[model samples]
Target chain A: MENRTAREYYENYLKTTHRLGRILTASVLILLLAAPYVIGIYLKAMPNIPAVLKAFLGVGIVYLVSGIVEYLIYVPMLGAGGSYLAFITGNLINMKIPCAINARDIVGVKSGTPENEIIATLSIATSSLVTIIVLALGVLLMIPLQPVLQSPALQPAFENVVPALFGAMACKYYRADRKAALIVLTVMTLLFVFVPSLIGSTSMMVIPSGALAIGLSYLSFRKKQKTSEGGNEA
Target chain B: MELLAELNSPVMYLICGGIILFVSVICIVFAVRAYRAGRQLGIDESKMKRVITASTTFAVLPSIGILLGVIALSGSLGTPWPWLRLSVIGALHYETQVAEAASEAAGIGGLSIANMTPEAFATIAFLMSLCIMWGMVLVIFNGEAYSRRLVSPSHPEKGGKKKKSGMSGFGDTAMTAMFIGLVSAYIASYIGTIVSGNGMFSFQGSWLPLAVAVTSAAAMGVFIYIKNRTGADWVDSFSVAGSMLTAMAAAIFFGRLIG
Candidate 1:
């Protein structure tokens, strides 16, 4: 009887903490979502809001927008609840939006408490908002000094940063289909290198051309398959 | 000499091209992987349908966006970009350029629209701009498609209970979250322009600001990296980087036209 009572008390305590975390997460998500409009209205109302506040507000707005975008575009297209949950949680955690409950932890909480549904959703949204705001803030704070960055000597190194970052990211997702990956990479490189000169710009054609190449390869595969089937029958 | 210096920035083109290439390669790699996965699943002709749907949707939209951008750029350079309605977008874009130039001429910390006509600015509001920015952000964020479906089996012999609640519905929540995120980012950009007392096209003039911009751009990637512990974390980072590259590229393209 004493052991039963102790177990009940512990369960109650866990439930209470879980509920509290949910509430906090939900509130933060709502605030992050509302932040853009709040800041927009505030800026419009009191134009004299200090530069630092304005900067933070600007950052907050970015986070808010990012949250909205993730909610709207991906959630609808993905259709699966687990996938959606993963996306929300992944976005929150990856975006580095700090929430009391780590996004990955929410997946584990489902077995113990049914309350994780709200916690997972809210925490994911909150984290995404936080990360987006920081990104915007970083850029907002950086734009006033373009001329110095563009100096002839500094240009080469500064320009390498974006591509280098992209390269690091790309290497992380190498395709299992080595041949297909190599073909795509080669075609994309040629487009990036040659098409810009041919079209006198690099902005648009690389993607379409690469896509067309992929399409043609698929067609060839289909034809080969059909030929093999015929040979087998004959 | 000053005008020539502005025009001759070759690094600008290199940066722009490299970013585009990065985006292209990322998209292509994913498309190829997706195709292989579909084939491996051996869903018969259904796999072909998925491929067709994905290729048309993912590959087409960005190509159109880029084509529009190239045409706009050509117009900026006073060269014909050889596309449909080239003149119309070119002219509207030119007006956009003029407005930017006029705003720039007004000078930093100069006459903001609020300062010149406070009442009119208050009355107009940024609802329209907000709507437009939201739309573009939506388009950019939603371009890549990742979806799954569970159809009831065709054979009566393989009967099973009909799915009452289709797909966990987490995708809807994700879409809503992403929309909110992009909208927040858009709002941030707008507010940043106001706070910085500069137009959206303003460039980073020094290493400090450049470093800041680069870090900010990477922040989105870092966020995604942390969220995805395994299995395609790279795509998340690429998406973030892609969005930033798009913004930066758009700003430069506008600056050239306007400045």
Candidate 2:
């Protein structure tokens, strides 16, 4: 009975979330396109369409693929509502993903559960709101804050945010499964060391490294199952 | 400079600000709905509050990092556009790259505010806005279906019992592995810099990222230890933020020392 209630609640939640998400995201897309259009009309400065397309073709093609890849890779982890919010807000790797992960861990919610989805959505929405506020504040204070924010002394901090963040966040997960973590880390490190040019392709690299880790983990799970079964037989 | 100033005009701010305002409203609605759903799900109000607090805290430094992106791009793209872009559906790196490309294509000679024209500005804005939007578009279409697959049962048998999906069993591990993969790649890239002497920071400053990472990791370890030992709930909320700050401070310290 409790299961039925929970399932019904989740189904309704997804229904509402998807409906809202579609409308909101579609509206956002229209607004985004409208920005350039409105600007072009106001200034009577329409861009050369061919040139824009040509240039976009060069870079947009790459980002288009990356965007699709990121969507597929991230949507599962982010869940339904969180994906809508996070994808729209951007900064997934450096901010929203970590925020959601941390929230889930702190609240002790398992992934793929309705509770986890709610927690992820709440956390991502809060993060997005905070980000918008911060960006607004920074814009308002860009003059006064410029020197400190752009200072060479403080530059390293911003530059290393990825390492700083993932190091700490990854350590928790690494601790959860040390063997898989160590093996994957070693393999990725070697790959990067050998083909340093591949550094720029880290997003794509998530595929191989993830597969390797998952493969190792599955093997471990099977081995553990076998061992337990043997002990049961004994 | 005049063209650049024109690009930063009040109309531009209004357009950008309006979009940002809309996005914020969406965020609020979603957050409220999610919160209510949590209540329906029997989640403790205290826990939901903690999630909000933690997410807000965790967001500060990174959002500031994004602010730095805006500031960097403001010199070229003007304050309003960068502000709007970074505030919604724009990443720091991608915005910079696409804006540069668009600017070059517009004959602005690659992201220079000096020779900017309205046409070039429009081009940059269009390309930057349009290029990275696939994620959102795809999500609009497929997000619900994909999410359902993740949590729903896969196979139904003759007895009317549904078999558990592979995603439910392996989702957590896959997510963890993806994170591990991401971190390893980043850490490895930094390590590569140290070894190859050919990457972004150069050999001299190459050690900085790795050192900062270790410091952050150690700070995280301390936070976890404190949380475990003292049963302090706030420690969990603050661990990532605290560790990031510590690591950033270490970066400055080590940066100066190495120099």
Candidate 3:
């Protein structure tokens, strides 16, 4: 009875949310897919279907595997509102996910709450808007700042954004639970060291690594529970 | 006449701008829903406001990286395409490669379509959008389902209580595990990059990236400590961003030093 009202409340939001999310996301996809072809037709430069398919497969096959992995790994982090927004707006692991997590942490909201959803939605939405604005600014400033942007001085920074980001962010989780973090970090390091080519395929490797972490955490959970139960018995 | 003379066509800008406008409109509607829902849940309006401000601040730095990405792509495809693609669904990493692959398939030897036929440009555009559709499809149809699976994952009802009091501990461990897993997968690549080609294992190349990663972790450590001692959660809020900026600066410094 206690949770019934809240659960029902969440379910209500879920209904309207799913309905709106699907419609909005679907529309964006349709527009994006059609834009290229429509432009081609108007310009009398319609894409050759064979050429399109060949080019697509060349790039598509890897993402075909990697994309699904990202959705599975990232959806839980993004929630419903954030998902529609992020998938449509793009830039997940590097930008939106970090923004959402920071927003949630700032307010100390746990995951899976309406509050968490709000923080994530607000953060991601805010970040996306910021990104678009920055891009618009970049479009205007492109010629003026062209030399600075392409300068060798700044090349290393942009090239290393992912490593710079994850290195800092990972410390938070590692502090929270050393056992799980250590195991995952160790395995990831060794795997990457032995098989350096795996660096290009990091997105694809998320599942296997995440599974190993989940499995280890579950074991730790069971161990803690068993010890606590034994303590109570004693 | 000089504005978009060569590759920056007027029509391209119009279409890209329209798409950006469409996404912004949808974004506002969703934010309103989440905002109202927050108030209903007894969340302080001020707290939500802070999340907005902090998130916006944090966003500025990473968005700079994305800006660099746009600039790189523009050199090849021109401004309108990268601007629209990156602003919408494309990532900084994927768009360049996707364009190159499509261009190559179209028999444009190099990735950039500078000497491009309109047909080749269209093919590249079409392919970039097509490859990214996988995640968007799931979000449209399966987002809510994923959330349901996430928030309540077969951890017995425990008197059917609505609060996560019962499974919060379980949730903490499981969620931590998953996050660490994802982060490790990404971080590992940096380690691999350093060790494999030339660092420890090969002994043939530079490990400047490895130094960047270590410096980043150290900076984060200092910020996290400041957060604990000051009890100013803002320090924690900015810790990750702070660390990233420092590390990026270090990359330039270290790149000059070693690599």
DockQ of predictions, in order shown: 0.02, 0.65, 0.64
User: Which candidate comes out best when scored by DockQ?
Assistant: 2
Clashing pairs in 3: A3-B162
Best by lDDT: 2
**Lowest summed lDDT window (length 10), candidate 3 chain A:** A1-10
Candidate 3, residues B128-221: lDDT per residue as tens digits? 9999988999877677767776654322352225643435457656667877888889777766776775544874444666666678889999
TM for candidate 1 is 0.30
For candidate 3, the TM-score is: 0.92
Q: Which stretches of candidate 1 lie over 4 Å from their true place?
A: A1-127, A133-161, A192-203, A206-210, A213-234, B1-259
Distance (Å) between predicted and true CA of A203, model 3? 1.9
Higher TM-score: candidate 2 or 3? 2
lDDT tens digits, residue span A67-180, model 2: 988888888778889999998899887888889989998998877677888999999999999999999999999999999999999988888887889879876778878898
Considering lDDT, which of the candidate structures 1 and 2 is the better prediction for this target? Answer: 2
The candidate with the higher TM-score, 1 or 3, is 3
Least accurate 10 contiguous residues by lDDT in model 1 chain A: A91-100
Question: iRMS of candidate 1, one decimal?
Answer: 18.2
Q: Is the docking of candidate 2 incorrect, acceptable, medium or high quality?
A: medium
**For candidate 3, what is the DockQ-based docking class?**
medium
